[model samples]
Target: MSIPIWKYALSMLTYFVVLLCITELLRKKYKLANIVWICSLLTFPLWLMGGVSGWFRWAKILSVILPTIVVGFCRIANFEERKGSFWEFFQKGWILWFVYGMLFLNILEATLKDVSLGNYANAACGFLLCATIPFAPKFWEYSKTGEGDLICYTTVGWNFLYTTWNLCFVYGESPNYFASTICILMAAELYPIFKKKPELYIMSRVYTLATHMILRSCFGTMFLKVMDASTWYNASFAKYWGILNFILIIPYLFWYMWQLHTGKAEISFKRGKTNNNVTTLNT
Candidate 1:
C-alpha cells in the first residue's frame, strides 16, 4: 500500500518525474495522460528520500533522457516528435540507456581493476537491443497530429510485466508496494483505453488506496516496529515484503491473465466491417 520506498525514493520517483519532463518534449510519451505526467513530479520524502542514500540516480536520469534524445532526434530534424507511445519508444529504444548503466558498472569494475563478465553481459544485451532499433521501422514511423502512436496491448503487456519483474529483482525480497501499486493502477487504466473498460480506472484507484491502507495497518501492527525504517531490502523484511507485493498484485496479475486469455480468444481489431464488429486493443 505504501509506495515502494526503493521505487519512490529511488529511480522510479525521480525518473518518472524527470522523464515526465522529457515527455513534454516528445510527440506523445505520456500514455496515462498529460495530467498524470504532471502529477508524477510530486513525490513524498518517505518514498524517495528515505532510501539508501543515493543509488541509480544517474542511471535513471540517463535512462529517461537517453531514449528521449534518441526518439526525439527525428522530431527535431523535421519539427515533429517520434511516432510511438512512451512504452514503444522505451520498449524498442532501451539500448543506450541500458548500455549506459552497464557501461557504468563495467567501468566501475575496470576502475577497481576487478575482473568479471558483468561488463560483458551489459555490453551484450545493450548491443543486441540497440542493434534492432535502427532497423525497426515502427520505431521510426511518423504520424499526423491527431493520429498519435497506435497503442498495442501486447507491447504494453510486455512492458508492464517486464517492469514488475525488474522491480522484484531490483528490490529483492523487500519490494515497494507503493511503486508497484501505482504501476498496476496505471496499467489498469490501459484496460479502459484498450478494452473500453473505463470502469477499471476508477476501480484501480480505489484498489490502490484500499491496499495501501490495509498494508499500513497490517505493517504497523505486525512488522513496522521491526522494519528498518532506513531500508526495506533486508532478510528480516524481504519475505513479508515479497509476500505483500505478490499479494498486493494478485488482482493485477489476474487482470493480465484475463487480458491475455481474451486476447487469444478474440480478434481485437480487423479491417472493414470487422472494424465495426471487432474490438481494438491499445497500450
Candidate 2:
C-alpha cells in the first residue's frame, strides 16, 4: 500500500497540525508549521485540476471559488479575536481533508498497480474503525476540548449517516476506508451528548452505534475471507450490508416513535451538557 497503514495513522496526526495552524493562525505560534501544512494541502486542488474531467472539472472550479471565500471569511473572522476550540473553527475541515486524502491515496495507489487501492483502503478503514470505535469514548472524550463547546447535533448525525453509508458502500462494498476515518473523526462530535451521566435514550444510542460497528466489522471480515481477489464486489453484499442495515433500522424507528410520543423527539439537533442537561439547540 503506497498509503501505508503508517500513513493512515499519520493522517490522524494531522489533527495536531491543524491545532498548530489554529495556534499559529491565532496564537501566532508555530508559524513555520502552519506554512508547511498550508502549502502541503494546496497541492491537492492542482492535482485534481490536472486530472479534470466531468466531475473533476466541477471540483476544480469549485476549488477556485470556495477557497477564496473560505480564506476571506476565515481571515475576517479571526481579525478581531479567535476564541473557541480548534474544532469550532475548523470542524468541517477534517471531512474535506478526508475526501482529499482518499483521492490522494487512490492516485498514489493506482500509479503503482493496475487497480485502484481505494477499495482495499476503504475496507481497511471500515474494518479498523468498526472494531475500535466503541472503545474510544470510554478512553476519552473526543469532542470536548475543555468545556462549554457547542454541541452540534448536525455534526454527529452527519457522521453517523455518512459513515453508515460508507460502511455499506465504501469502495462500493460492506466495509470501506472512508468509513473508518469518518468514524474516528466523529469521536469528538459525540462528546457533547455523553459528557454527562448517561440518559435513558443514550443507552439506545450506544447500542445502535455498537450494533453497526459489530455489523460492519463482522461482515467486512466475512467478505474478506470469501472474496475473490479479482473482484471487490461480494455476491453477498445485498445479503450482508443491505440486510444488516435493514435489521438495525428497527431500533432507530423505536427510538423515534418513543421520543415522538413523549414530545421530546426531533428530526434534527440535540444539545447535551456536562451537568446532565438536555437542551434543544434545534427542533
Candidate 3:
C-alpha cells in the first residue's frame, strides 16, 4: 500500500499538538516523571511517521531520543534531585542504554534498507517495545511499594499486546515482529527481581502481557473482518486500528498523569524535607 501523504501529515500535526499539550500539563503540574510517560505515549506518532521516510520521521526520532537522553543524564548527575542507590543507578542506566541503543539501531535499519517511511515508523514502533523491557524492573519495583500498580500492569500488558498484534496481524514473518517478541519476553523476565513477592509479581506480569496480547489480536482480527465486508465503505483499516489503539491508551494516559501529580507528594512524604544531597537506597 502506498503511503498517503495527507494522512502522515495529519498524524504528525496531531502528535505535535498532543505532545505540546502534554508538556504544558506536566509543567503546570510539576511532574517530571510524566515526561517519560508522555514520551512513551507519544511514540504512536513516531511509529506512524517513521514507518515512512519524511520530516515526521526525523521529528519522531528527536522527540523520543532527545528528552530520554536529557532526563536520563540529569537523573544520573543530579543525584541530589533524585535519590537512588547504586542498584537503582544500574537499573535506570540499563533502561537508558536500551532505549538509546535501540533507537540508534532503528534509524540505522531504516537507512540501510531504504524502506518507506511507513516501514521506518514500524521499525520505530518495534524499538519502543524494546525500550519498554528495561522499564519493567522499575515499574515492578515501584508497584511493589503499593503504588502505580495499574500503570505498571497496564504498560506491561500494552507492550506485550503490541508485540502480539505485530506478530499475528501486522508482520508475522517480519524481523521486527521477532525482535519485539524477544523484547517483550525479556521484559517479562525482569519482573521477579524487584520484590519479595516475586512469584506474585511474575505471575501478574505474565497474565497481564498475555491477556493484552490476546485482546489486541482479537480486536485486530475483528476489525479486519469488518473492513473486508465492503469496499465502498471507504474504510481505512490501518487508520482505524491506530485510532482504536489511541483510544485504548486513555486509561494509561490518565494513570500517568495521576502518577506525576502524586509523585511529588510521595517524595515529600518520604523525605519530609527536600535535601539536595545524595540519598542512598537501603540494600
Candidate 4:
C-alpha cells in the first residue's frame, strides 16, 4: 500500500504540535498535571475492562505512571540539593535503582519481542542498547523544578540513540503503527533539544507516549485508519534497521564503557558540560 506523503507529513506535524502543547502545559501546571496523571492511571482499569492485555500496553501504563510518581515524589520531598532527609534516603538509596531498573525492563520488552520475531540482529542491537544505559544512582539523579522532577541522564546523544532504537523496534514489531508513533518520538525530543534541557526528555516522552497510547486505545480503528499512511514491512527492511542500530550503538557503547572505566564519564557527547555526579562511576 502506498502512503500519502503529504497526509503523513501533516499528521506528524499536527501530532507534534499537540503533544508539545500538552507537555508544556503539564510542565507548568501542577493541578493540570495531577488531573492528567489521574486520567492516565484510570486508563489501566478501562483497559482491563475492555480486555486490553499486552506487554506494550502495560509498558505504556508504566511509562506514564512511573514518571508521574517521580514528579510527585520530587514535589513532596521538596529538598534542595541532596539534604540528609529521609525522603532523600528513600529516593537516592533505592528509588533511583528502581526507576532505572524499570526503564531497563521497558527496553528489554522490545528486545524480547525482536528475539521472538526471529530478528536476531535487531535483538542483539536491543541488548547492546540496554548495555549502554547508565543504571547507577549517580546517573539517575533527580533534578527538581517548580513544576516537577526529571532524571538528569537523558543527554542529547542518549536521546538520539534511544529515539532511533525505539523507532527501529516499532518499525520491526508494528510497522503499521510506526508512522504515527514517530510523531510522538519527535515531539519528545523537539522541545528538550531546542531548549537545551535534556533532563526534560523523560517528562516530554511520558506526556507524548501516554497521550498517544490513550488516544490509540480509545479509538484504535479510526486512529489507525487515519494514520495508516504506510503499512508495508519486509524482512530486509527489518534487517537493515537491525544492522544500522548495531553500527550506531556499538562504538557509542564502547565509548561510554571506556568513560566509566576511566572515571571520566560525561553525560553529553559534547564537551564542557558534564553532570554534577559524573565524578562517580555509574556502576
Candidate 3 total steric clashes: 10
lDDT of 4 by residue, 101-170 (tens): 7667777888888888877777787787777777656665544445535554654666788888888778
User: In candidate 2, what are the lDDT values of residues 221-262, reduced to their tens digit?
Assistant: 332233212233464652355345444444554554565468
Look at candidate 3 and give me any clashing residue pairs: 50-120, 50-121, 51-117, 51-118, 51-119, 51-120, 51-121, 52-117, 52-118, 53-117
**Between prediction 3 and prediction 4, which has the larger TM-score?**
4
Clash number for every model? 8, 4, 10, 0
* Global fold similarity of model 2 (TM-score): 0.36
Estimate every model's Cα lDDT from 0 to 1: 0.33, 0.34, 0.36, 0.68
Runs off by more than 4 Å, candidate 4: 1-3, 44-51, 63-67, 79-92, 144-146, 267-271, 274-283
Q: Tell me which of candidates 1 and 2 scores higher on lDDT.
A: 2
- Which ranges in model 2 have alpha carbons more than 4 Å from their true place? 1-45, 49-53, 56-150, 154-162, 173-235, 266-283
- What does the lDDT come to for candidate 3? 0.36
**Per-residue lDDT for 6-110 in model 1, tens only?**
535554344234332332233244233333323333322333433422334323333333333443332222223335564334334433234334324422422
Root-mean-square deviation of every model = 13.0, 13.6, 17.0, 4.0
- Per-model TM-score on C-alpha atoms: 0.33, 0.36, 0.28, 0.82
* Model 4 clash tally, residue pairs: 0
